[model samples]
Target: MPTHYVYLGLGSNVEREIHIDMALSMLEEHIDPLRRSPIYESASIDPRQSPFYNLVVGGSTDLSLAELNAWIKDIELLHGRTSSTQRFIPLDIDILLFDDLAGLHEGIELPRAEILDRAFVLYPLQQLAPHLKHPGLGISFAELWRQLQPGPQLSSVRYPFGVSSFALTVQAGRFPLPGDPCQLAAI
Candidate 1:
């Protein structure tokens, strides 16, 4: 069984595709059986700023929540993530969920706030985990997305790299059933 089942939100507007790809590679080093949502493009906080490429990844981690946060912060710094006043954020990774534990742990909140408020996070997350209830809200992600007021339009991006290889059924709480093969990415 997986030790720490989690979901993460990733975004970038600085060399968006390359940064996202690089971040995904680093994340795979610590999170196994990673599954990702299709890329989504949404306008940045300011319409004049470069649009952002965003997606969500789900997987299991062997590290505790605090250890994972430290690793994630390291990834951002290594990627040259910088102030976005000029829209030059190389990469940004946020911990959206860590198992089902709610409230705060190690000064980090579970089921990140963005999951409920940001379309970039919510859309991709629902694709990867539509039925999994929010650890705090107790409502399915699918339902939360439905309740959301219209926000920035999120269009799919045809990112030709990175693979989303985990099974959606895993989010539904069933994995590796008899004769069920692991999900494979196309391209």
Candidate 2:
């Protein structure tokens, strides 16, 4: 079986921390040796809801795109996510990018548009794969991040469960931290 590189975006507002950890656990069980980006907390796009915590996780999988996507959606459902419950999401997982494939497949768009339109998605993606080129745009994530205007909503914070070592590079000053960056040395 050939493995394809996959990047997934995770977010939650209700039971934010716990849900994120649960999702990570599920990912580890499903995708070995997951590489994660540092967690980013941001105000909900929906003003009425609580703030959301977001991050990206990457891994190589032998599963087909549709199969992997369905598996992730199942994981979210297992964690209490429901399309019927719009106000609070216990776990939200999105297939952000899949092996440089473009166009629509299995009813999901490749290189999800949100990756460029939303800061919550882009920031963590840039952190995880800075040099990766957008299949559609053909520009590096790091360059896309640089061209984007900074927003006040997203900030780097330490999660109690900790992040992957690759995420730690941010603390070493490789990337500029958002507002009030966490003092990682103390953690």
Candidate 3:
């Protein structure tokens, strides 16, 4: 099958660690044609849940946008996620970008602003595809890193779980999400 580039955002709070594990395993088993983004850990925004473990994954696949999204929704359900309960959950997966405005649904959006706002998503994305320009923002990952106020402190924090040794070369400023049209202009 021909492949199209796609970006996915991942998060877990309810049973943070275990949910992430299940999500990853499900991805590998069902979301084939995948390459994972760097994993990031961050505090949960919802008061009802624990801290979240977040990350983005990049890859190309032949599945139609809706088809792929449906599969993901199924995975979320298996992990105990529900559309009605949004405060916090064991797992939350979103389709960040799908091949150049190709996959957006009637209500669905792309290059989620949340990706840029959260350090977890940006840092890991820098590791996985730093050179890839944001669909909306013209700035590269290296450029965004340079623009960040203090820059990501990759050296200071250590993750309890295993991490890939993918190092990003950041240049130090905050960056916009790839799919955001405003951010795409940076490219």
Candidate 4:
């Protein structure tokens, strides 16, 4: 079978510190990634809580879209995720790009529509691989990064996580859950 290009977006606001790492480990184990973006830290758009650590991973995989989605949900459950919270969790792994598919399902949404609204996701995604295009949108992550208004409180750190800093960033704060727009953009 021909491999498909996939980009997965990761976020964790609830159990910030441990969740990102947990999610990353799960992703690494389950997906055959060619590369992963450096983690970016940012203020949460949702008003209720704290900031989030966001990043994108890119790779070619043989798995079909449904298989990948199944794996993503399994990883989230393993990390103590409850989709109901809107509160932050041990992990939130989203399928940002999957062969140009888009829309919501079973009350869940994909491609994270608000992706353009957050500077953190776009910047780090640009840093990770500026050339990669959102197949559905016809725009490159780096291109989108330039158009975004930077948030003063939002900040991004370098990647290949060290224990202390990674821990500190992840445990930061829980922001209100993202709305449909942010969630859909990544799709």
Winner on lDDT between 1 and 3 is: 1
List, residue by residue over 142-180, the lDDT tens digit for candidate 3: 567656664333322223344322211111143435553
- The TM-score values for the models, in the order shown, are 0.82, 0.84, 0.71, 0.72
lDDT of 4: 0.66
**Model 2 RMSD, rounded to 1 decimal:** 5.7
TM-score of model 1 vs. true structure = 0.82
For residues 1-187, write the lDDT of model 4, one tens digit per residue: 8677777778777656577766766666646764676676776667675768777887777877778788888888887876746576567777766655566643445566756776666665677668767655778878887878866455555444554433334454323343412111111
lDDT of each: 0.83, 0.84, 0.65, 0.66
Per-residue lDDT over 42-63 for candidate 1, one digit per residue giving the tens place of the 0 to 100 score:
9987777789999999998998
User: lDDT per residue, candidate 2, 21-116, as tens digits?
Assistant: 888988887676798888888998778988999999999888899899889889988988879458998899999999999999889899899888
Clashing pairs in 1: none
Q: What is the lDDT of residue 148 in candidate 3?
A: 61
Q: In model 3, how large is the Cα lDDT of residue 155?
A: 21
Leading candidate by TM-score:
2
Error of 4 at 75 (Å): 0.7
| Cα shift from native, residue 180, model 3 (Å) | 44
Using lDDT, give the best candidate's number: 2
Q: List per-candidate RMSD values in Å.
A: 7.9, 5.7, 11.0, 10.7
